[model samples]
Target: MSAAFDLEAIRRDFPALDQQVHGRDLVYLDNAATTQKPRAVIDAVRNFYERDCSNVHRGVHALSQRATVAYESSRTTIRKHIGAHDSREIVFTRSTTEAINLVAASFLRPRLQPGDEILISEMEHHSNIVPWQLLRESTGAVLRIIPISDEGNIDLDAYQGLLGPKTRLVGIVHVSNALGTVNPIKEMIAMAHEKDIPVLVDGAQAISHLDVDVVDLDCDFYAFSAHKVYGPSGIGALYGKRKHLLEMPPFQGGGDMILSVRFEETIFNEPPHRFEAGTPNIEGALGMATALEYIDGVGLEAIRKHEERLMKEASLRLPEVPGLRLIGQARQRAGAISFVLNGIHPHDVGTILDQEGVAVRAGHHCAQPVMQRYGLSATVRASFGLYNREEDIDALIRGLESVREVFA
Candidate 1:
């Protein structure tokens, strides 16, 4: 956070950043997909395997007890990080995708019925859209998409018109993975509450960039993957309000999720544990906690400010390149910028950028409907993160010189 925060020191923690992609330093801009883990997170993961390794919640053995403490301690750490009122409200799932699926399966599928509408914005990722679609297919609930404005933000008045007595759940992304538009979720959540419709904030692209207070947002459920926030893959969290989690049925049936298992009847455990089935990824959870600590230590506000500077600087400089069209000019955004090249296909641009050792994401970014909303098939996206520097965008610009030459 200070002016003394060393970029080189932070970059050194990520071993992957030291590699050469194409005779150049790998300038990775795909932070939205998964952030490179810091040395702290990596060490935390390694420590688990090296010293403590055992199944959690069921063992009195020394190894099991140590592993269980590390794993559950991670949950406690995260609960405080996200401002959840209770630790039991936090459910560990494989990733954000699985977390959303848990809500769709255990909660929405049971309560939703024919003619009920599940409202979402056009900008939701495929994970958010598909799970609700699945619930629709099973329960016959209509899926209504709130439209986006020309500026790439959701039309809130349109959303209000869509919400009514029949509207059951509002599943919207807090930040667009494709557009990088930060939705006014606090307002949206309040509106949904006024109408008694529960809202679930898909925070995959948000938690890495902003502080999320689940109680303050007042959303029924919020889901995000740890890997997106500089943690390891195969780990994520679902934060559900205690009342909602208590009412919802168990997501998966297995060893830890049950209180007592019988051939005829299996009683499920309480919230969080009820949804977390099987022997959990113990190391991943501990590493995720360490990852949050890494952020907390550096301070999330500072990271946000640094990325904001990069975004503004990149936005100002990039438009100078001819035939480069910036997409998603929302008033509030974070960590990502989507753009289209005049004559080059998105894939072609990515291929050429890779030649310069500059990596960027290309495609709809799992937001097919959002692409359709903006009348685009796909676009090349360069996203920023904590470790990114102004020189990174300069490298990105230098890489695009080839795209201009080739397309010209």
Candidate 2:
């Protein structure tokens, strides 16, 4: 009903939104986990398989050439999506986990010395935390955490203190998946640069909701997943500075990653090819490009405004429910909200919500450190996307009311 955006028209593009569950209209609020694909993205994947299915950068035939163009074109699209300087800076990976691991292994591990430090925030996902732990085990480097306040914002002063002469790299999430806290990445990156430390931003939860510019942020490394942005699974991208990608070693070695091979020595191809080993996810890349195009059509500024309105409405209404406690009250946030009901397990709340045809996520959200910080085992989460509307929030509220009635 808002003049700036037509919610119904936007909803029509996503076929999955027009469905029923348990004889009631489906209300999907699990977008922080993975987004439902738009029809354009789905058709792009199907078209690739139906007409242009072939291995990229290897075949000489028409299908192969077509597939190669589509695949590589997606890389270019993604490069522009994040405002990287060149397409070669974008390396395709299976997920954000792989991208971060690539940077941790090839970029940071070799450079680290005993007693060197890698700084991360308290709100990082396990993907951001565990890789550094593995690197620390191998190289004897120390991992230092930047403490977060009770409201879930990273303590800026604490973060500055964590940066010292021994600090080599900083890995932080641009947005908290569980708490929806949007970190001050630009400021944080500048702060780290003051100590000449490189920073890698985990943008998995941010790319879909915000207008991300790697050039503007001047981050050393940035990563995000396609599925989190209404694209297909099994494909994502890591955007590194040209200087870093050229210097870093390959994460995986296989066909297409090398210029030539022999018994003596294999000449490695330049990145992003060096990082993309084996047959790349050609279909996935094309589908992801279509998804980005879909987002572009909607306009990120419009999406941000719409989601902000929804967040404000939910913040006002959800608290009115008896015994429901909203967690992570950060002044700046997006995409999701985590909460708990007194005496009710999160799984129980999720199950009850499902009976009323409201889909949500229930668990630690792969951020157990965050749960530990809050002194809880798990919390129920409701995340948003472009297709979401006020009706979805209303449905979630009514479902919670039903849960309260049952518990009473």
Q: Count the backbone clashes (under 3 Å) in each candidate.
A: 0, 0
lDDT of 1: 0.92
Clashing pairs in 2: none
**In candidate 2, where is summed lDDT lowest over 10 consecutive residues?**
1-10
Instruction: Give the Cα error of residue 261 in candidate 2, in Å.
Output: 0.6
Model 1, 1-408: lDDT tens digits are 445567788898888888998799899999998899998999999999999988899889999999998999999999999999899999999999999999899888888879999999989999999998888888889999999998888898998899899999999999999989999999999989999999999999999999889988888999999999999999999999999899988887888989998899999998889999899989999989999988888888888988999999989988888889998999899989999988789999999999999999999899998888778999999998899999999999998988898878
Q: Which candidate number has the best lDDT?
A: 2
lDDT of 2 by residue, 1-408 (tens): 224677898899999989999988999999999999999999999999899998999789999999999999999999998898799999999999999999998999889999999999889999999999999999999999999999989999989888999999999999999999999999999999988999999999999999999999999999999999999999999999999999988888889999999989999999989999899888999999999988988899999999999999999999999899998999899999999999889999999999999999999999999999999999999999998999999999999998888888
| RMSD of model 1 against the true structure | 1.2
**How well does candidate 2 match the true structure in TM-score terms?**
0.98
Mark the regions of model 2 whose C-alpha exceeds 4 Å error after superposition: 1-4
